[model samples]
Target: MRILIAEDDPSIAAGVSASLRQGGHAVDAVTDGAKADAALRDTPYDLLILDLGLPNLDGADVLQRLRKRGTGLPVLVITAREGLRERVRVLDLGADDYLVKPFALAEFEARVRALLRRYTSQGAPELTIGRLRLDLPGHRAWIDDKPLELTAREFGLLEALAARPDRVTSRAQLVEALCSWDEELTDNGLDIAIYRLRRKLADSGTQVRTIRGLGYLLEEVKEGKESEA
Candidate 1:
């Protein structure tokens, strides 16, 4: 999962970023509403953690603008305000969830998981393709009920591919899924990740096939074919 944190507090932003990264998500932090809005406009993210006290354009205004622009991106508003009106205002302005300040890290993480599950999986916890299974919340994958060990990038690649099994996913789309604005992913970087993922899935009866001038596809191994080239 990719997330953008729009917070003016350096400490809170850093802490949230670390926690999200540790939880196997790519994260980017912006300290002001202007930058936050620009980041949202420029990148694709699974969620946004926004603070209402942001500078250079209040966070509520940012949310309003985003909604006006027809972006249905899931937003979790973090604010110190405890008033019902404030909460209702943000919710009415299109924030999907709200967290008051001084929240426990555990609770925050749980809320994040809940929101992601609601939006991304629509209540489904696992994705299955033949003998392969991806545990979305657990950040784990399995083949024939055996655990599959994979690096973070490789797991992300697999998740993207498994989301649409057998359909060709372009290299550009894969790169967007694997990288944030701060991280640069070249064609070679993507190729290396694909090669490593293919090797890891070699014995799982699942194959990641290159589509020549296109990108790649993930599919169950065909009968009589020992491997994918």
Candidate 2:
């Protein structure tokens, strides 16, 4: 899962980022609401962990803006406020889940997983990029009529990439998706995974393209098997 952590406290932000990364999720941590809003606007994230205390803009304002723009991204609010009214307000403001400050890391991770499970089960129960299709609910992938067997890591990489098909995802993001914060994941490990996944995807005539210096994009092939524009 790709998550956005909108936290201002340096220590707390680091801890949250590390914990989420350790849980095999790609995380982008920001210290202010403006940066957090910008990140959400530019990227396709599976989940969001937002703190009420933020600079340049308040967390509530950020949530309000996102809703106004009709971005229904799943949001998990983490705040120090422990009042019943505050919790209700955040929930009513469009947050999918809430965690009080000094929350247990295990609880936080569990909530995140729960939200993702619910999100993936909705819609068509499948995500598609041209002929490539992933049955999110069934945890299956297909290239039109053929099933493509994929390892856990490969499947995770495919979901992260194929979720926002046509967009590029960085190597660092994929590394975080495959390995937790404490895991010693080398760049080569990601490369190897990509190489294996590419071979698996070859049958679809769709390829994972490397953009020289930036990252990778899962591109579908045209009738002649040419890469998508």
Candidate 3:
């Protein structure tokens, strides 16, 4: 998952970034709301870990603007503002979850995972298409009771595909979801990732079908059957 951490405090930002990166997530940390907004506008993020105290536009304003433009990016407000009213206000402004400062890294990680799971599953943890099962929080994928060995990128791709089964995911979107800004995302890179994922998930009967003019779509490929498209 690609996460944007908008925090003014350097220590907090670095800590959050490192923790998230170690958790196998692509993180982009910004110290102010303006930079955060720019990042949001340019890239597609699965989650946003925002601090209320921002330098430029303020966290609330950034969120408000995003919502105003109909961008429903899931946001978790990580702030020191523990007051009841403050929490209520942020929630009202469309923050999906809130975590007070001085939190344990484990708890914070759990919260982020939970929020992403909810966001992707639309409030459900288990996403199933045919016999394939995806446990979002557990970061596990199963097919017919057998677990598949998938790299983080492959797992991310599968997760994204499972979120909208049978929906075509453009190469660009898949690249964004699976790679960080620093990674070289080429057409061949996506192809290679898909190839590896397909091989590992052979038994699952899930195939990454390439649409001639569009992109790739994940669907159940019957045993001994192939996609004509």
Candidate 4:
């Protein structure tokens, strides 16, 4: 999943970003309210970690504008404002979840997973098609109960493809999912990753079918249906 951490404190942002990256997520860390707002407007993030004490714009205003834009992007407000009423205000302001400072990274990661599942996975931790099972939070996949080893980028691509099944997911969307805002993913890298993924799923019931100029899709390999590049 791709996530944004809108935190001003450099150390805190680094800690949180490292944790999410270790969990196989692409994370973008921004230090100000204005930057956060700009990022929210441009990037498609799976989850947001926001701090209320942001400079230039403030977290509450950011949340308000986000909702006003009619985007259902899941927001997890991480702030030091510990009053119960404060929590209520943020929640009412459209924050999906809130966490106080001095919280455990483990708890934070868990909350992130919960919010991602709630908004993106329909509250399901896993996605299945035929004999393939993808543990979304764990970033592990299995075919016929055997593990499918995947790098972070590979898992990301597989997740994107799995979401639509037989429907095409555009190359641009796939690139956004696999690369961070700062990184560049060339066509060669995308093709290499897709090739390796195909080799991994060769014996499985499902396969990644490329749609030439359009994009790629994951679908069950039928007996007589030919797959195109």
> Order of candidates by TM-score, top first?
4, 1, 3, 2
lDDT against the true structure, per candidate, is: 0.86, 0.79, 0.81, 0.87
Q: Looking at candidate 2, what is the lDDT of residue 170?
A: 90
Question: For residues 1-229, what per-residue lDDT tens digits would candidate 2 score against the true structure?
Answer: 6678899988888987887665546678888999988987887777889999899999998898888889878999999989999999999999999999898888887787677767874645677766778765345788897898887678878876776577898987777666533455688888888888888887576778888788998877767765422
For candidate 1, the per-residue lDDT at 15 reads 91
Q: What are the per-model C-alpha RMSD values against the true structure?
A: 2.0, 6.1, 2.6, 1.9
- For residues 1-229, write the lDDT of model 3, one tens digit per residue: 7788899999888898888776667777888999988988988788999998898889999989888879888899999888999999999999999999988989988888888877776778787765778886567888879886677777877876776677898877787776666666688878788888777766566677778788888888776786332
Off by over 4 Å in 2: 121-155, 161-191, 198-229
Query: Which is superior by lDDT, 1 or 3?
Result: 1
- Top model number, TM-score: 4
| Candidate 1: tens digits of C-alpha lDDT, residues 195-217 | 88888888777889888998889
Query: Whose lDDT is greatest here?
Result: 4
Cα deviation of 129, candidate 1, in Å: 1.2
- Candidates sorted by lDDT, best first: 4, 1, 3, 2
Writing each residue's lDDT as its tens digit, candidate 4 over 1-229 gives: 8999999988889899889887878888888999999999998888889999999999999999999999999999999999989999999999999999979999998898888877766767788875678987778899988999988888999988887766899998888888776788898999899998888887677788878889988888776655333
Q: Model 3 shows how many backbone clashes?
A: 0
Clashing pairs in 3: none
TM-score of each: 0.89, 0.65, 0.86, 0.92
